[model samples]
Target: MSSIIYTLPEGFTTGTDDTLIYFYTNDRPSEKNKVVFTKNMLCLLQNGIKVVHTANGKEIVTNEEVLMLASGSILMSEQTVANKYEAILIFFGNKTLSDFCAKRRLSFNEKSPSKSIFKVPQDSFLKNFCLSLKLLKEQGNSEMNEVKIQEVLNYISTTSPDIFNRFVGQALAGKSDIKIKQVVGLNLHNGLTTEELAFLCDMSVSTFKRHFAALYNMPPQKYFLQQKMDQAKLLLSLQKRPSEIYAELGYENLSAFSNEFKKHFGLSPKQFQTENGPGEKAFGLPEQQFFKDVPATL
Candidate 1:
């Protein structure tokens, strides 16, 4: 998927499955990876800490914390020393949520987090439930794995109504309000298609473009390109080679990347590097102050 930042191992459920479990362990610490949550996700950081940055504020999730990320894009910065970093992630979509509510005859009408991300208050049962999920996964028992998902849901519904509502409440509320600022700010560095971005914002492509232009006074594509160019200039200033940064900017080939850079700054990538070198000002539009003032909450 366009949103995948890391290729998780095979024990996790497929997208089509009603429930999913993700187990991640890395012996070598990796550079921070940005990812877009394609579905509503529940994450339990079992070991090591994770720092998540969004258009809003940054959140630090530790083993004692449980994080709930709405269906949206987010920049995840992972950190670990010599020790292995591990986490258990669970994903449930609208369909699975609908089935759960219908079967339990429960109500989920509360308003959800105004921002796309939030930390859920820890529950003792929830922690234990996560441990059981790990056990099921280790056994490779697909059937038991699904049951563990339901068990956690049932626990939340019965013992912790507030947490349950916060977890799936907004998702059950149906489509969210499409705020131009939130959508654009969150996806500035993201490599999502216009159509995918529209879907996340709960708007048709035409509507998204119309609203975007009205808000920013320029077409979305133009704004996106400008942002990318600004980032490229910053990377060049840091002495990063064009080859290393091109793919990160979503370009497929060096030739195309150079052409775009030349068009934007009147210099090819190599020529710009040769003149500006490292630690020198690379030519491009000055950083936009608007990004600095992005709202601290979504």
Candidate 2:
């Protein structure tokens, strides 16, 4: 299924750097919605179930738990039990987490796995904390939002040390190279724009381009086009028709894909296919075998 891209905080009615406390309520249930978190987030589900699908697996959160998600992409589905879904979403940046750790002198095990999502069980204290945030949002006391978020971080660190440490480690481990790799690998076949990819990686477009070049030795647009052309050639050699593979390669239509294929290989896809015939093995080996030797970073 085609996925919708959303960058939180930017999509909200707040500035990018501001820590936003948002009361989210919906009357409808949604399934498999793709969400790319540009900032670290804490989601306290009050009256619904949230299933987050990540590379590792799916995590389910309900009223009994809070979800702490690192900046990344996930397929999320929300279900309401009483014809309404509700949650409190808190968005903060890496700097906020770093400053919080510094102020508290918090130390975590370096060997802890840097997980993308942490499910924190909701207790009486957390339920009360959620209530306080909802009240603050209703009272329009946005000035204290950051302070309140920090207070919750402090509470988590004190009460659930392991989860807190893993969350912190995940935030700390989100380096430029790692984040770029993750975003690109997940979206390689999706044909997302540069700005969208940058947003997903939580970086500015220029910064994303710079890091992308360092890793791939070419600009992102060029690298992506080359990869698509290479894959198209392999598919055509396997007897897949141009019309059948264009959409799968992220092209909108046959004409656009054909034009690009010609530009890259100096021959239209049909002409190339006619000359090479089926099962010709374009890269000297089967497609699966050829991809096995490719670098993991790509």
Candidate 3:
């Protein structure tokens, strides 16, 4: 079997079964999308599992339900089939998790603080998440209640949402020079105003925007709001209070935050919490609201 290795830039844990993650394919066809799956599968990436499919004499990732496989390719997998191909991973076993970690080739120790990275063997994550997903199989969730699922999601969010926010923040903030070897990069604050940030970065306002744009798509001011919103979505998912989130975001007035959030996202921040709080799985809200701000060139 051909194995793919990834030097993960962020740490991740999934909150629920409805969430699917993509590491390398940002802004590509295979970028994040809502997927359909029959059997339960949680694709965790400790060792990078490359899903290849063959089409027109080449490997291609076919468009299928949750798992898409390219119809053509030659490889050593007992599970291989035509017209469909996908990667499976299992990390429950100690050896399995170790094998995945062996391939994390990036040196994250270059920074002041080291980020703790962990992964489930690919199949392990897939399976565990599926087992947690009672809704996917249409299984009666009369037994699965909010409090229990929230606890699982809370654990996943503790490790991942912050990491994802860090990635999006670092990219949006134009911090290419900073060696971001881990997901949450030392818990650095990303919400900085252009005026406030220029002073912090030791650059003049004009110079800051110019340098910042090179690394991030837009100027820092616009990007900061978007980044905060993304983080807020993740927070809301765990059933955090809107008033607290507003305070956590350092907004003096909750009403102002709510209005802008509603204008930008098509739903008030409070509405988002109600609609998608724990089990709605509405992952597309932020993208729809803030994608317009990304530089056209990006």
- Which candidate's TM-score is highest? 2
Q: List per-prediction Cα lDDT, in the order shown.
A: 0.69, 0.82, 0.40
lDDT of 3: 0.40
44-81 per-residue lDDT for model 1 (tens digits): 87777788877778888887777877666677766764
* lDDT head-to-head 1 vs 3, winner: 1
- Per-residue lDDT for 76 in model 1? 77
- Clashing residue pairs, backbone N/CA/C < 3 A, model 2: none
Decide which is better by TM-score, 1 or 2. Answer: 2
| Sliding window of 10 residues with minimal summed lDDT for model 1 | 1-10
TM-score of each: 0.50, 0.57, 0.35
- Candidate 2: tens digits of C-alpha lDDT, residues 1-298: 3467777757876565647788889989998887888888999899989999988888889989989998888898999988999998988887677556655657654453735779888899999998888787788787888789888999989999989988878776744665566577667779899999999978899999998898679999998898788789878988898999999999999999999899888999999988887775566776677678654433
Instruction: Return the TM-score for candidate 2, rounded to 2 decimals.
Output: 0.57
lDDT tens per residue, model 3, 1-298: 2353221111233333322233222221231222222211223222222343222232223222122211112231222233333333211221211111222322222222121112222144434654455353366553444343333333443445544233223222333233211211222234445676666656688876776676456776676677667767767766777887886765677897788788878998778878875644446444444445442211
lDDT of 1 at 290: 34
Ranking by lDDT: 2, 1, 3
| Model 2, position 173: C-alpha lDDT score | 74
